[model samples]
Target: MNILFVADPLEQFKIYKDTTFSMMREAQRRGHEISACEPRDLGWQTGQPVTGQVRDIRLTGNADVWFTETPRRLAPLHGFDAVVMRKDPPFDAEYIYATHLLGQAEREGAAVVNRPASLREHPEKLAVMEFQQFTAPTLVTRDPAAVRAFHAEHRDIILKPLDGMGGMGIFRVREDGLNLGSITETLNKDGAETIMVQRFVPEIAAGDKRILIIAGEPVPFVLARIPQGSEVRGNLAAGGKGVAQPLSPRNREIAEAVGSALAPRGLLLIGLDVIGDYVTEINVTSPTCFQEITEQTGFDVPAMFVDALEAEVARGN
Candidate 1:
């Protein structure tokens, strides 16, 4: 199988912790050919299928330089056995444009994981709104009055932009409401943009748990990213300490429900961000923690992912 990963630059990957690198390693170990390209490399023309300047790569065991690559050459996306969309988000216009190209590639008979249309449909932050039954009291609005009302009712709340990633632009307005108006203005851009406000779930003190669901089934272990020092965000990118642990019953229930609901829609891999018993986000775009969980729990997450990917491609064939 030739697997082409549509991801960020291969040069920027921190091989020790990068989930896409882990997947690449597993696929290579299974004797599958590995190729890669950045979203920017993808191109489409009227007469041509979606094509990308892709390079075949082999993993090197070196710590500093982890991979060796061939010179890039243009290839139609459908030529690969599987096209894995592992691009990280702000899910900005460019990313959406990449998905549009990938969607066209799928129409050309490419097996694209977590289908491009599904990625467009499920914005990680806004995706949670669909499953309010498993979330904290959440509100989405651009109006400062609505945010202030939510803050007043909840007393302690979290405000975040609709498109933020890696914990950027996240704020907690406490009971005192100091800077509540200011934070709202910053997040919502004074009625120009919408933002999400949710009642702060204090269970965050334990950790923000990342529950991975592959092929509509919950992995038994989860990576709990515990916030360090005075930070409210438990994202690993925000310097959270990741601790791999067995999934709690509540986590399992939420993962199963959400996983089953989303799997049929072409979401083969999903990461549910759960705080305490409630899911905080549905991370379908480039979900991580594969290396952390596997290293800590010996669960072989990358292998699981490859197995599912292979099965998916086989089914598509």
Candidate 2:
């Protein structure tokens, strides 16, 4: 199998814990060929299939320089056995454009995990709304009055930008509402942009759990990212400590329900952010924590992912 990863630059990867690297390693170990290209490398001419300037790469055992690759060459995306989309998000204009290209590649018979159309349909922050039964009292709006009203009712609430990733632009306003107005203005861009606001879930102290669902099945273990010090965000990138644990019953329930619905829509992999019993986010674009869960629990997350990828490609064939 030839697997082409649509991801960020190889130089930007921290091989020790990067999930995309883990996938590449597992695929290579299984004797699958590996290639990589950033979304920017993808191109399509009027008469040509969607293509990329892909670099064929091999993993080196050394940690300092983890991979060796040949020079880039143009290749049609449909030529790969599987094209994995693992680009991190701001989900900006360029990301949307890349998805459009991937969608075209899919039409040309390329096997793309987490289907491009589904990625466009499910914005990480907004996706949770589709499964409101498993979430807290949440609101999405840009009007300051609506935000203030939500704060008045919920007292303790979380405010975050729609496009934030890794805990960026997240704020908590308690009963006193210390910085509610200011935070709202900043997050919503003074009514120019919309944001998500939810009643604060106290169970965050236990951890913000990340449950990985592959091919509509939940991984047995989840990585609980616990906040450090006074931080409210439990994202590992926000200085949180990651601890792997078996999924609680509620966690499994949520994962099963969300997974079943999403998998048929072509999301081969998903990451659900669960705070207590409630899901806080539905991550489709580059859902991670594979290395953390695998290292602590020995569950082999990347292997499960590769198995799913193989199955999908076989079915497509």
TM-score of each: 0.99, 0.99
Cα lDDT for residue 301, candidate 1: 96
Clash totals, every prediction: 0, 0
Q: Which tens-of-lDDT digit does each residue in 1-317 have in candidate 1?
A: 99999999999999989999999999999999999999999999889999999999999888888888899999999999999999999888999999999999999999999899999999999999889899999999999999889988999999999888889889999999999999988888878999999999999999999999999999999999999999999999999999999999888889989998999999999999999988999999999999999999999999999999999999988
lDDT (CA) per prediction: 0.94, 0.95
Cα RMSD to the true fold for all candidates: 0.7, 0.7
Task: Write down the lDDT that model 1 would get.
Answer: 0.94
RMSD of 2: 0.7
How far does residue 85 in candidate 2 sit from its true spot (Å)? 0.4
Query: RMSD, model 1, all Cα superposed?
Result: 0.7
Please tell me which predicted candidate would have the highest lDDT against the true structure: 2
